[model samples]
Each structure stands twice: as structure tokens, then as C-alpha cells.
Target chain A: MNTVWKENALQVIQDIFRNQFFDDSLAITEHTTPADIEEWDSLAHVNLLASIENAFNIRFTADDMANIDSIAVLLATMVERGAC
Target chain B: MAEPTHMLMMAKEHCKAGEHARALEVLRSLASRHDPLPMQAQYARLALTIAQGLEGLPVLRVAFLAGSTLDHLVGALRFWLLLEGFRLEPYLAPFDTWRQEAADPSSGLYSFRPDLVWFFLTARDLKLEALWGDQPQQWQEAAAGRAAEVATLARQVLATLPATVLVNNAEASATRVLGNFEGSVSWSAASLQRRYNLELAQALPAGASVFDLEHLASCFGLERWEDHRLWCHSKHPFSLEAHAPVAFAGAKLIAAAKGKARKCLVLDLDNTLWGGVVGDDGVDGIRVGPDAGAAGEAYAAFQAFAKSLSLRGIALAVCSKNDPDLAREPFRSRQGMALTLDDFAVFRANWDNKADNLRQIARELNLGLEALVFVDDNPAERALVRAELPQVAVPELSADPADYMRVLAEGAWFETLTFVEEDRSRSRAYRDNAARNACLAQSSDLDGYLRSLEMRACWGDADQARLSRLAQLVNKTNQFHLTTTRYSEPELTALSLADDAWVGWFSLSDRFGDHGVIAAVVLRFRGQAALVDTWTMSCRVFSRGMEDFIFLKIWEVAKGRGCTRLEGAFRPTPKNGVVATLYDRLGGSSVQQDCGQESRWHFDLVAPPPDLTHYIADANGSGN
Candidate 1:
């Protein structure tokens, strides 16, 4: 169960980042942050968050909108919302 | 369960990857389909890629003066316009700089000279915040002050430019502090904001039109209307997906202003109008009403919707590949039927290709093929027509009869800003043409046939009462328009009052019925030449010698005004090819050809040719 959940969550996050940024080869680890990618600006960050929220059927608060800049924060929000 | 929306995006994606052939196929699919674009078009970067590949599309300069961030919305706007065969050249004013751009004449807004200026000021933009227990007068004061500012800005835009201005009504407040009682509270944010929208719409300048975002929010559902989290991050009023409808509404408004609105809704018989085939299952066996159960009721409801559309002046037509009597029997003898034979302007039921039938229908109704919106239940028939005559809009109708009315209404093919008595009387004029056609078959020769109809015409100076029809003629008449110039009703009124110009309207009546205001003319009295700036006639009277009757009066009025020469230009369009040699046939000499695209023609008024002959007698008796 743990292995299946991790794979599915990883696939969903990867697909959202790939489609949203239109970069097919893009890969993300939990530690990845805005400083690691040049395309993840403030506007693109909102787009990425919106895509993950839609994919997970969840909502984010205003604090999360401004503070969630790394893949670690996104996974934490997704798990807190019972997405995993 | 593949939605048609997903398939349409293939065109842009394929074109992005340089797959030309696949892109062409999907673009063809997008063209043949009906309804609006989907939300996936919000990717601004992708839309630019698709737009860059398209060649020779008409360009509309649009300026967005908004209080919110517009970086993401511009892509969806350009995507919708591109789907409608127009490329959007938009100038985005800096965030919250609308007041500065609209007031300063030398600002970038004026220098861009946009054809459409979109003002998007949301409720938040106006600071209509909900109060816990503030004074009731506070809400009213804020609403009224913002309303007055919008009205003043609208006047300034109209005074500075002649372009069409689209002002979005503020979205009602999402915070319903009083819940169900919010509407009843005078000082509540929802109540005050609603009143502010009404005041702004009513007080706008004559040329500006409201976009009605409040009504759009209700339809789109206020729950998902705006994202608060994204608003805090980007200052965008709504999420990217919600901008789809806004973009579509803007494109349709621009299209209607340019006279690209579809005029006719052509339907098929058989399973289309009833639950069963009319020919296979006879009129009595067909199911089409409340008594015929569920499927029949759906067809009946669709029929009622068509009747309402005809009342609003959208010409209805029937095109079927069956025997004429069998196809029309349901309307003839059936009970509980919403549509009757009289509702349709033209009925073509024969064993011919649907595309050819549509061509004949357009010819009989005196309309361009682009003016038709064809609806059929058969996919093969829709595909054939789409491939052959691409100008005709063939909707991707489902097999379910219940979805017919919804699909057609969502197409919004007949979008118009104004409706007049003239529009309501359009079907009557087209129906009269049928009787005239039957008379033509009985007469022997052209002259003898026209004489038998007993046609009488009335010509006079176009006044306010005739402004609607005159504007329709000058703006929408594609064929036989000498100059093809467009003018709003207000502009036309101003031109009529000028001393050096003459604007006249002509109406014709025959034994069948009256065809009201069939032609309009605008002539500028130059020193030695009376130039014809505009000459547009209804296509319904195309071959009835109406042009001959109209041109005789043209030079006669110019000669009476003491002009030595009568001059005009033939500016060509795709649909105006029928009138390429109009001035030449009118005994006028071609003086100059501008790059072989537009030509100038002249007629010597001092020694004008003999007046053209027509059978119609003058009823007003003022134009000698």
C-alpha cells in the first residue's frame, strides 16, 4: 500500500508539472524548490498549486498560496488533505 | 466518452510541434464544429504559438484597460478570436492604470487606436467591501460614487474615439453576510453592488455596451467564479479557467459589431424534427409532442425554441433529402406541433446533396452561405456539408433530441446588440419572395414578368424612423455594396444632417407584400463630383431590377445637386464578387485601378446616359 501510494502521488505531481510548464522532461523531487528551476516564478507557482489542488480535489489557503514554494510543502498539503 | 473539446486542442498542439498535416485536419474539425472554445485555451504561451502560425486572418486591435492582472486572460481572448478567424492585437494597460489611460488622450490606449476597448473593473476593484455593522449610507455612497466614475469614463472614451467600448458589470459580492436576507438589506454588499451595475449600465454612453459579468457569474456558478487564494497571489479577479467564457463573450460581441453574426438557422427533417423518420414512419406514426412520451417532448420543445428564434427575426429553413410532401407532412397535419409551414422561409426537400440544397436556399433567401447555421442529426450529412461548403456552420449535434435546443442556443449565432421592428419583419419579407418566385414561372419574359407584379417604390430622405434598416443595409449588406462602408445608426444620423451629403432610403412593395427599406445610399457633394460613399441594397431583391431602379435615381439626384461628374469606388470582398463590374454595367467609365484591388469609376452627369428601365412605379413621387 505504501509503495502504490507513493508511485501514484509521484506520477500525479510529475504530470502536473510537465503539462503546466510545457516541459515534458521535467522531473521533481520532494526537496525541489523555486531556486532549483528558473521557470517556477510567482505566477507559475500559483498555476502549479492550482493544478495540484485540482488533481487532488483540494483547496489551499492564502498562506499556502504565498508560502508553498517547494515540492516538500506541496506533498505535505496533498497528504494533509488525504490525497495520498 | 471523448469530449469534442479535447479533440479541438489537437490543432494548436500539433501546429506547435510542426506537424502541419495533422494541424490542418484538427483545424478543419474546429471550423466545422459549433459552440464555444474550452478552458484549456488559458495557456497564454501556447495560444501565441498557435496564433503565430495562422496567416492572413483579419486583425482586431483590442485594448484591455483593467484593474486586475491581465497577463493570463489575454491568451484566452486571443484564442477565442483566432478560433473565430480573427487575430487579436491586444494592448494591455498596466494594472490599475485604466483611469490614466482612458483620460489622457496621448496615452498608449489612444496611440494603439484599438477597435474594441474592454473595461474590466470588478467589485473588489471598486472596493465594495462587505461591512459587519457599518452605516447603510456607507454602502450606497461607495456604489454611487463608483457608478458615476464609470459613466464619466465611458463618455470620455466615446468622445475620444469611435470604437466600440465593452464595459464589464462588477461581479456581485461573494460574501453574503446576511445570507438569504442579503438582497433585502439596503446596505448589504450584494444589494448595493447589484444596484451599482444597473446604474452604470443605464448611464453609459450611447456607443458603449455592458458585458453583464453578474449574469455570467450566476450561469458559471458563483462558487467557482473566483479563487481567493489566486487573487491574493496574482491579483487576478478570477482563476485562469473562468476566463474562457469572458473571452468567448468578447469575441462574439466583436463579431456581431462587424456584421459576422449568422442570419439563418437551417434544420433537417426526419429524426431531426421528430423522434422517427418522417418518410419511413409516416406523419401519423412519428412521435413529436407531449402525448408521444419523453423523446417526443424533447423534439416538441426544440420546435418551440425554433419558433421563438423565428419571431426574433432569425430566418428558419428546411433542407432534407426526402420527398417534399413526406418531409413537410408533420407540420401540415400533425397535432401539438410547435412549428408550422409558415415558420420557415425556404423549404428544400429533394434527393440532392445537403450542401447543394443549402446553396439553393441561400440563393432563394438572398443571403451569403456564411449566414447559415445548419443543424442535422446525421453526422455523415453534417460532415459532407462541412467539407463542401465550409462557410456554413454545421453544429456537432448529438443523437439525443433533448440536447438540440441547448446546443443551438449555446452557439449564439444570432448575437445582436439591438432588435427593431425591422428584424421581426424579416421572415415575412422572405416568405413573400416565394410568391414572387411562383409568379416568375408563369410569365414568359423578364420585362413582361416584372410588369405583371405591379411593383411600387417609395424613396425619401432617411430619417430616425428608418435608421435601423438603413444601418443594417450599410453595415451588413455584402453583395452589391459599391463602397462597403460601415456606419453606426448615430453616425448615419449625423451624416444625414450634414449639408454636403445626401442619405436616402428606398422601400419596395409588390402584389405579394411589402419589402421595407430595401436600399440605402450615401452621397457626398464634392465641388465638381458627387461621390457615392455607400450604396447597399437588400439581397432579397437582387435580380428584380432594383439596382437599375436605384442607380437611375443616383445620378439623377447628383445631377440635380449641380455636380458635373458622379464618382464611386468598388471595394471588393469575398461575398461581393457578384458586383465586381457593377459600375461598368451602369454606363460608368473606370477611371483608375488601385493596384488592381480597388477601382474608381466615374459617370459624366452633364451628359448622363439614359435612365435604366424598370417596371416599378414611384409611390412617394418626390425623386424626379
Candidate 2:
């Protein structure tokens, strides 16, 4: 993985989650899963994905949506697609 | 709360200064426009500003009964309606329980008594999947059946309370499971959904309107509009970015239905309407009309837009801070232009404040200041009018002339429920009215001038042929009589056919042109007296003596139907005091008076005033 790209992507994703979930101080690590955050419901997850796409200028396929259950999985998918 | 954005800070300052409306203006512009701020950031930034602290702003209670979860739309709708100066009070019915909530009298929907009820349903809600491979017969039957089913739900809510209802037709799924064959086969989901959409619209109860969600989705591009992933995960109807546009459009539609539509568009000259200042750049130098190439085409397109508005009954006027002669030069000598000087009803070119000029335009047109919308390219002028005359709409238009039409069209300032035949002549009628008023000012002999005008009055029942015009007048007229009620078409239809009721549509025209359905009145017969249910007339024909002419026919018809007396009432609004003494002038005696509420009047059929004189003659040439 590109260390700089991974660091920047995580920062963007963290800000989106913080803003959309109305928690100004939310933090996420690569190990975090959907089960760890109660507010990471389907509605918020969909909104989060859209916000990331808008911020990163990328599109996500349906397979990516289904496969990305954890932050580690999300990073891995981004790395595999060279989005990172 | 997070750090407030610059626009949010402006809203907060306005709130602090007791300028809640101004605050809404800032926030609404931020949300409605395609701003640089991302959707999630914008939505998150505006979440806490639901404005519950503001006092005395007009409130609109809205209930959303949708097949899918609408938690996000409710928030965005608040920001949109706030721009229209209404605080939203939303009641989101439980997911997919719309049928139950609408049917049960004791449901929260009925108890909440929303001013507007929205029904957002889709193909899945119609249960077309059950008929999947079943024959083409079930496709047709299911569409009709499901439409009737949902229409019944709407009727149930309407029966309990009087509210504006908007139903969303089913969207044709983009999946295209049968690929290109979807268009060819009647059994395809998309084809069946299209049929369901048509049936749903046709089956809706009277006064209810379809929201055209399918068209909206198509405009947004179906690929971007739908997300099967979100649908499967949470049953979200459309994409998250779709919410803002939907809410903005939905608010404009509701505003139109509530009679908040604009009647006049006031344009600014110079670089605003065309390219370059007329004083600096002569008619030949001014970049307008098609002769001027690309930049000129932009101005011509904007000019074409204003012309189209005039053709559709929206009065146009010119207010420029330049010399009158120079301002008139462009429209007079310019060739290949989309507009002419004759297009404008009122033209004032002087160094007055544009805000006061807008007021003068409204005064000359006999319309309220609320009826006018000011468009100017100068930011200072826009800010000035927005500050001085808050009632007149000043859109946050982009500086680029190429974007003017898109901005204006998206603003949806001039929306109407129905278009009457008279709308085609409405702008021209305003122009002619100026001539009539000028004639009124110059003539020493009022009676001679009135007689010389040669006015004609046509009267008829509000039958199917005239129902649309009748409904248009009733909806547009706020206060032309004792009671002010905007009746729907179905209600007007029932009244016209009722044996014990007499409803009339009055059309008046002089040598100028035809004024279609200028006035309409409804009366209910009970015992020996006819009670006036509603009597509304367009403000355009005021002072034309049409009132007396219509009153004469009212009594003639009432007496023929065995009525011995007539009862009416006078309700006062802030601006309708011009007609405060109307019933008195019509020879009606005060029966009861309730200060600040209503005043009742009674007129005996044994005698109408012998001196009730009008210059208008019957269309049949039977002048009595």
C-alpha cells in the first residue's frame, strides 16, 4: 500500500463520517468494523459512501458496497482498484 | 455544533437581528444552488438549524407518507420551504404504513392535520411483482387495481380534512430486466410501471396532483438517481444527492398550489437584460439579439425567456437607471431581437432606487408588491431590493448571462395550477388597462367615457366547458367578495350541477380584448334565501362595473329559482379593504356585524336598488 495515499484517504473518510453522523470527533482505524459503530447503519453507510465518492472523485460498484464491511476491507478494495 | 460556515454565520446573524426571513434567504440559497460545498457537508451543516427558536414565522404542517424511508428528505424539505418563508412542521408516518395511516381516522395523519400531504410510492408498493409472468391481462388489471387502491387512501385522508395532496407516480425501474425487450413487451416491469403511473394519476381524487417523480428521475439521469445497493440495504427510493432538488421542486409546487405564485417579472436594463449599458453602448453597439454572435445569443436567449413568460400571462416591465430615451432605443430600433417595447406593460427609465421603481410597477399594474419579482445583474441592486422590499422576489442569479435562463427557470417563480384561455391575453390586458386608466384620468365626463368604451358582459353556468376557467379565477382571487375560499374543480363541478345551487362564470370584454372568466360566484339555496358560498373575481377587472352587472344577473337567476332574499358576508384581509363597502354599494343592508371577523348583509328580493347603474351591456344585446 502507498502510505501517503492511505493516510490521506483515511483522513477524508474520517471527516465524512464525523460530519454525516453529527459526531464532530469520530475516529476510525483500519481495523474498525461496521459492528463497532452503532450509528453505522445501512442508511448512514450509503450516505457515507456517496460523500466519499464526491470527495475522492471516484465511483463505487455494487460489489464494493457488499464487500466493504470493515474499514480494513474498504482500504483493501481501494488499494486493489488503485484508488489509494 | 461544528464550526459554522460563512453562509451559516450570516444566517445566525440575521436570526440575531430578528431578520428570520433574511436568514432563510441565505440558508436557502446555500442549499438549493449547486454550491461548492459537498452534499453531506451541507446537509450536516444545516441539520441543527431547523429554526425551532424563531417565533411567529408562518408554519406549514407537512406529512410524508411514503413507501420508503424519508428521514433525509424531511430535513432538506425544511430548508427548501424556509426559503419560501414557511417553517416546516413534518410528520413522517411509519415506513410502509401509509395505507394504514391514511385509512384509519384515528391515525396520526388525521390527528396531526397537516396542511400538505405527500404520497411517495413506487412499483414495489404497487405489487406488480406478483403478476410477473402471469399474462398481460393481470398487468392491466393490477395497474388499475393498485391505482384505485392508492386513490382510496388519498380520498380517505381528504375526506377527513381539507389539505393539499401530492402523489408520486411509480418510476419505471432502470434495471430493464428484459433489456431492450422491456419497451416491446407489455409484461416488462418498466412498461407495467409506466402504465401504473398513468393509472395512478387518473385515479387520484379531485384537487390532488401528481408530482411527476418519474420525470424528475429521468431529468436527474436514472443511472445517478437509483441505487439498487441502497434499495436492497435500506429501501432508499433514490440517491442521497437527489433529495435537495426534489425538495426544492416540491416546495415550489406547494407554493403554487397555495397561491403564492408571482404575477409580474420586473427586469433591469443595461448588462442585466442585455450585454453592455445602453448609454455607454448605443443600440448598434449593444450586444443583444442574434446579430451579435455568441455573447449576443446568450442575451437573446435570456430575452426570449422573458418574452415567453409574457406570452404565458406573466406581465413584464422595464426599470432602468438610464435616460428614458436611450433605454427605449434598444427595443425600438434594434432588429433581430426577441423582445420589443410593446412587450412591457410598464416602462420606467430614471435614476430612482430600483426598489421604489418595483413598487411603482406594482401600483401601475394594480397588483400587490408581493406579485412582483425583480431581476438585476448588479449585486448592489439585488441586495438593495432584497433589503428594502422583502416581498418582491430577487433570485440569487449567477453573473453569467448564459446561466440566466437556467437560474430563472429553476426558481419556478411563475407557477400556476391551471392555465385559462385568458392567460394568453393577460399581459396584453395589463398593457391595455394602462390605456384605460389613462383614459379614466383625462376624461372630464366619466359617464361619457364609460359609455364610449363599449363594454360587453357574457354570463353562463360553470359547466364542463367553462370549469377550468371558473376554477382558475376562484383559485387566483384571494378576496373579491365577503368570503375568500379557493374551490377545487371537483367542488366547483358539484356546485354547478347541484339543483339547489346556482354558480355562474362571468366573462367581460370591451374593444380591447377578451377577458376570459373575469368573475365567478356560488350561491346555496336554503329555505327562501340564497346564501353566498363564494364570490371571487380577478383584480384585473376591478372598477369596470362588472360587479353590478354580475349582481343583477345573480338576483335575476336567484328569483327565478324561487329565492326571496340573499345573504352575504364581508371578511376583511389586510389589502382587501378596497371592497369593504362593496355590499353597501350593492344596496345590501347590514344584518350583523362582528368586528375584526366578518360582517353579514341581507338584501330583499322585493327590491334591488333602482340606481344600480353600469355602463356594461349584455352580450346578447339586451340592455336593460
Candidate 2 ranges beyond 4 A from true positions: A1-84, B1-4, B10-30, B33-63, B87-94, B97-115, B123-161, B170-206, B479-481, B555-565, B584-595, B604-607, B620-623
Task: Tell me the tens digit of each residue's lDDT in model 2 across B379-454.
Answer: 9999989889888888877878999898888787897767667889899999988778778888888887787678
DockQ-derived CAPRI band for the predicted complex in model 2: incorrect
Candidate whose DockQ is highest: 1
Single out the weakest 10-residue window by summed lDDT for candidate 2 chain B. B36-45
Q: Could you list the chain B TM-scores for each candidate?
A: 0.91, 0.86
The digit string of per-residue lDDT tens for model 1 on B168-269 reads 888875667688888777677787788789878777765578888887777677887777777887798886667777777777777887888999999998
Error of 2 at B109 (Å): 5.3
For each candidate, report what fraction of the true interface contacts it reproduces: 0.32, 0.14
